[model samples]
Structures are given as structure tokens and as C-alpha cells.
Target: MQIVNKAVVFESGHEEYAVPIQSVISIEKVNFINPIPHMPLYMRGVTKAREDLIPVIDFESVLYNRSLAGEEARLLVVQTESLQIGLLVKDAKEIIDIPQEALKQMGIAAYEKTKYFIGVAAFSDRLITIIDPDILVSSLEGIKDIQEYMKQNKLFPA
Candidate 1:
């Protein structure tokens, strides 16, 4: 018997990326994102979802070094062990089952930022870069600063 992992595929720029479906809480359309001061450039701001305020990050900027243009961007609400944050993506494509065998370990040294990627998998006719949400959330610049802001603003419990 083999284990099959499910992933939510989304588009960012010209490439496709996947995150384990188990980590995803919901997919949401872009709504009003209130900008916060003194946060990282990639940190778009905060938004209310399901009666809770969540910080949203511009994943395109974090991954591609540029913010996404236009109004078609969507939010991928991901929940980790400690935190739940919104990741801005171009679009949410579909949920697909990827075999464990199909995932290939990527050489961390070869990539400029190795922490952002977990592995690669073949889906359809393209190779999708699998994103590690934990790393992505933890590695963001000014995360602590944002957390402090949230706490000060009573957005997060101290």
C-alpha cells in the first residue's frame, strides 16, 4: 500500500505551486485588506474572516520579488499549529491527489531561498513547486513586528 497526499494547487505569476491540503482551511476572494504600518512589504495587511482578524501576506511578492497586479488575486487561508494566516495567490486552481513517490526532493543549495520550497511534484503536464507553509510563514520579514502590532492592537491575545 502507498500513501497519497492531497494538495491545493494555486497559480503565482507564471508558475504553479502546491501546499498540502491538510494545512489549508479555506480559499477566499480578495476583499478589503486594511494596510498596517511598519510591516514587511510582502505583508499586505489584515482582514476579517469567520469573525477573526487574520494577517494576509502577498505571496507573489514573497515568492517572486514583486507584488501581484490587478484584482484577480485570491487568498489562501492556511492554518498551522500556532497560527492562521492568509496567503495571496493569483488564483486557486484545484485540489489534487499527488502520490508520495512522485514528489522529488529538491537540492536546497541550488535554490537561492531553499526554505520556501519543500519538494516538487508532477501534476498534469507541469511540475508544481510544493510550498512549505511553516517555513513560508516563519521566514517572512517582520513577522515578529507584525505579531507585536497585533498584540498591541488587541488583534491577538498576548
Candidate 2:
């Protein structure tokens, strides 16, 4: 008898997508208790977790140029070098294990106009675009202002 196989599964944009579980960090409940004024549209708001106020970055809006349409969202905590940020996902799904061969490089046309989505991975009938949080944070004009405020407040890195 022959048997079929399943692959790495994850939640993206409220859909069931799959990727290597190795790329994923444990999902957490988004704390919507804090709010900031004049934040970019991609910034849903700020939340406090473990005594740190982390900015919740809206994933879909940043990547697809869309807005929050009332879809439930979650916070994906990701670490990039020395900086750690929370990714605001509309819906985070389960983790699945798939073959690395399924991954492919995204064409330049997809990012020639914008550097938002870095790459895409195909799983089943869905296409999942890998979001680079650093790019979003670095490109944000408010970052400098925030940094300045932090420096004035003595919160700047010493």
C-alpha cells in the first residue's frame, strides 16, 4: 500500500499555510492595552508583554498594502539580530512539516517597486510571502522620531 504525505503548516492571513516549523516562534496573545498617537497605518498599536512595550506591526497591511478588515489578529514575536519585534498577524495557524524543495525565490517584479515582501513559499494551494520585519521598522520615518524621544527620555541604548 502507498501512503500520502503532509508538509509544514502555518497560519498566514487567516489561511492555513505551511512552512518549516523551524522558522516559527511560539505564538502569543496580543496585548492591546497600550495605544500610541500618530503611528503609521501599518502599526496597529503598542502592547506590553513582560514589562516591555513592543510595537505591534500589522503584517498584512505592511506586506499587501491592505487594511485591517476586522480579522482577529495575533502577535508573532520574532528576533532579528539584536532587535526583537512583534509581528501582528491577522491569524496565526498551526505548524506543519514540509520538504525544503517546495520553497522558491520570488521574482524581482514582485518587489521591484517595493521591498516589502522578500520571498514567497508555496504550500498546497496557498502562497505565503515571507515578511521581513526589519525592513518595515527601518523604512518607517517615525523610527527616528521615536529614537530621538527615547534618547531624550534616557531610554536610548548606552
Candidate 3:
């Protein structure tokens, strides 16, 4: 028996990253994102996906401290503990299975620097940094309020 984790691979700048496939609910094109004022710079806006309005975070903005990049943009609609948030990325067309043994856990320094990183794993010839979606959502400031706003507005079914 082998322990393998299925993950959705995405690109941000020159680096590759992955999140548990189980966390992702859908992959969508960049239809339209309605910007919300006074939110975090990285929090691009809210977008409708599969009848649910999810908070979209610009991955490039978060990582590179710049606006969203890449020619083809996509939204990785991932379900965290309490919210179905959208992560806008350069690309998200690959789903791969990563073996448990392949994961290289980050040391204390790495963990201290990034709380959302689960580990690093080599897939194909590139390095993919595994990200924990729960921590990714929780680590952001003012995200809770966005979740609450969605719930209170009945944006999606309760």
C-alpha cells in the first residue's frame, strides 16, 4: 500500500506550487472579477463560480508583490475550513499524485518564514511547493470578515 496525495499544480511567477486536490472544487477561466474596495491588495475581488460567490486572491500579487501576470489566468476555487475562496493563478491545468515519501518537510527556518507551506516535492524535473489551503486562508488578514460578509449576505446557501 502506498500513501499518495493527489494535488492540483499551479504556477506563480517562475515557481510551481500545489494544493491538495481535495481542496479544489472547480477550475474556471477568468470570466470577470468584481473588485471590492478597502480589502487587501492581493484580494483581487469576488467572483461567481458554480453559483457561489468566492473571494478571489491574486496569487501573483501575493507572491511577487505585483499585479496578476501571465497570458492565460485561471481561478482555483478551493474550499477552506469555512469559505470557498478563489486563488487566481497563472495556470492550473495539471493534477498529479505526489507520494508521501517524496515530500521534503521544511525546517524551522522555512516554517517560520511561510506558515502556509506544507513541504517541497520534486515532480517531473521541477520543484513544487506544497501549500496547505487552510493555513493559506487563515494566514491572510481580513479574510474572516470577507467570509462573514458572504455568509450574512446569503451569497451562497447556508
Clashes of 1: 0
Q: What is the TM-score of each candidate against the true structure?
A: 0.90, 0.67, 0.89
| Residue runs of model 2 more than 4 Å from their true location after superposition | 1-25, 64-66, 69-71, 109-116, 147-158
Q: What is the alpha-carbon lDDT of model 2 when measured against the actual structure?
A: 0.53
lDDT of each: 0.82, 0.53, 0.82
Best by TM-score: 1
Give lDDT tens digits, candidate 2, residues 1-158. 01113323335456543323333354677656354567667766556555655556666676567764444666776544334456666666655433455555667625544454455566677666554445556766566554454456454242
**How does model 3 fare in lDDT?**
0.82
RMSD after CA superposition, every candidate:
2.6, 6.2, 2.6
Clashes of each: 0, 8, 0
Q: Local error of candidate 1 at 99, Å? A: 0.7
Give the distance in Å from residue 133's predicted Cα in candidate 2 to where it truly belongs. Answer: 2.9
For model 2 the TM-score comes to 0.67
